[model samples]
Target: MTMYWRAISEDQPGPKWAGLFAEYWPAYLKWWLKEGDEVRASYRESQRMLKRHMPEMLPLYDQLCELAGGGDQAARFLSFYCPPPYLSGCSQALWPGKAPVLVRNYDYNPAAFDSLILRTGWMGRKVMGTSDGLWGLVDGMNDAGLAISLTFGGRRVVGEGFGVPLILRYVLQTCTTTEEAGQVLSRVPTHMSYNVTVVDRNRKYLTAMMAPDRATLITHAAVATNHQENVEWISHARFTATVERERYLLHRMSLHRDTEEKFISNFLKPPLYSTAFSYGFGTLYTAIYRPRKKQMEIRWPGTTWPLSLDSFEEGARQVNLPGAA
Candidate 1:
């Protein structure tokens, strides 16, 4: 399947963001309400949760709701509070070189993705990343020279908390350093298990294993795959090869003296790269972020599309991938 990907710049949440919401809402609504209306949180509860946990994002949440026409379902969905269960495969690690760069491969079904790069200046803070659920980010970097990425922790337990993408959005919106990012990640609860990694301009980083049933585990490990401290779900671990991917990354970062180019190239191939689209683990894209330079790039095997806060041109590209449809 060929995906039409676009790079969009909306300094604020207005017409452009609204248009994209309208285009994607129908499909999102279906997914959000997949279990049923009663299973999801109410608009009131979602808003209250957002205000309590991420008060800084309340104003932006209100603005996005207004842009979404202020419907109950849309507002609740925007809040990203305990909604539903979802999962994906991903791997993230920091480059060993002096210059700090965080690289990751987002493995998931392409049909479920927004497939766009969003550059937004919400609340006067410049932020951009691969957008999910319109405003949430699967991975993104802010003007503060901090970048973050997420991988689904292999588990079946679900509890009360926000979906992780919004947590990432909040981190990029409010935090400037890895320390602050770690704090936010540790405090905020997630509905499911997720290993969230953050890297700042100084390259100071941490991986927070966040979940709803327990306290967040903040580890100094620079590399994270699908599972957390342990593979709680044996079947999921085997299916996604979370252990193998983690070993590959650890060995590569320590054993091989790969240059930056070679290190990133490794993620596009086997072990780290995935093609299990039928099982929702296909490698959608490899994202590389240089927080110090304020630059980001979306890379395929042979093609590279570069973007930045300084020169973020608005355009679209067609990418052909396997099993996306």
Candidate 2:
């Protein structure tokens, strides 16, 4: 199946939202129902918390429910309020000094690679990012010069909390700085372990290590990968190289050669960018967020698409990942 990318903008919520979500509704339903009772219970708990704390999101959820046929199944599908599954091999780093930029490689299941879509809409700030099931964002940038991205925090634990995507969405909608985003992240609950890397217009950055059971760990680091101080999920096949990937990024950053072209050249290569197609991570696309410029660039090997707050356009490109069929 060919993946489609569409952009929509609205001043106030309306029926037009349905078409944006309907494209992936079937596949979303199939993935959502495949889970067992335990996962369903977790989703219910997440919904309750979201209702209480993040009431601003309720109306949007209502719109999605009504659009998805207005029932229990539709609500569950729109909620997307379950624990996040483990994904590996994401490397995020901040360019030092003025005019800071954030570059990230989103690696995940090949099946979801084709389902990817980038959403840019008006909220508190002009926001744009890519999502899989269409409920929340995977990575995005807001007009306030804040850029946020996620990676599996390298742990094997699940609890009652919202998925990282929604938390990220909340940050993009509400916060304007790295400190404010960190506070929001600390207060909100998450279903599983994850690391969120946030950079702001002021050149400040933070990597939040978040899980349901513990307090959020805010680290001021230039680079983040699948693991933290040490590799926790070393036994898992996907994270065997977590430490190596982390080291590669840090070593490169340590050289003080902070040129954009150098980093892009390296990130587009092996280890930093995954090509595995068997069962683990595969690099779908590289996203570069320029906080000062208020712009974003989606880069594949040969082609690139640029977007900004003042103007936007919907586009799609067909290309093959390095080692895929």
The TM-scores of all predictions, comma-separated, are 0.98, 0.91
lDDT of 1 by residue, 112-159 (tens): 899989999998899999999989999999999999999999989999
Q: Candidate 1: which stretches are off by over 4 Å?
A: 323-325
Residue pair clashes in candidate 1: none
**Candidate 2 residue-wise lDDT, 194-312, digit = tens:** 88999998888999998878888999887877776556677752444667777788778776676886786667877878877665557777888888887887776776778775576
Q: Global lDDT of each model?
A: 0.92, 0.72
Residue 55 of model 2, lDDT score: 73
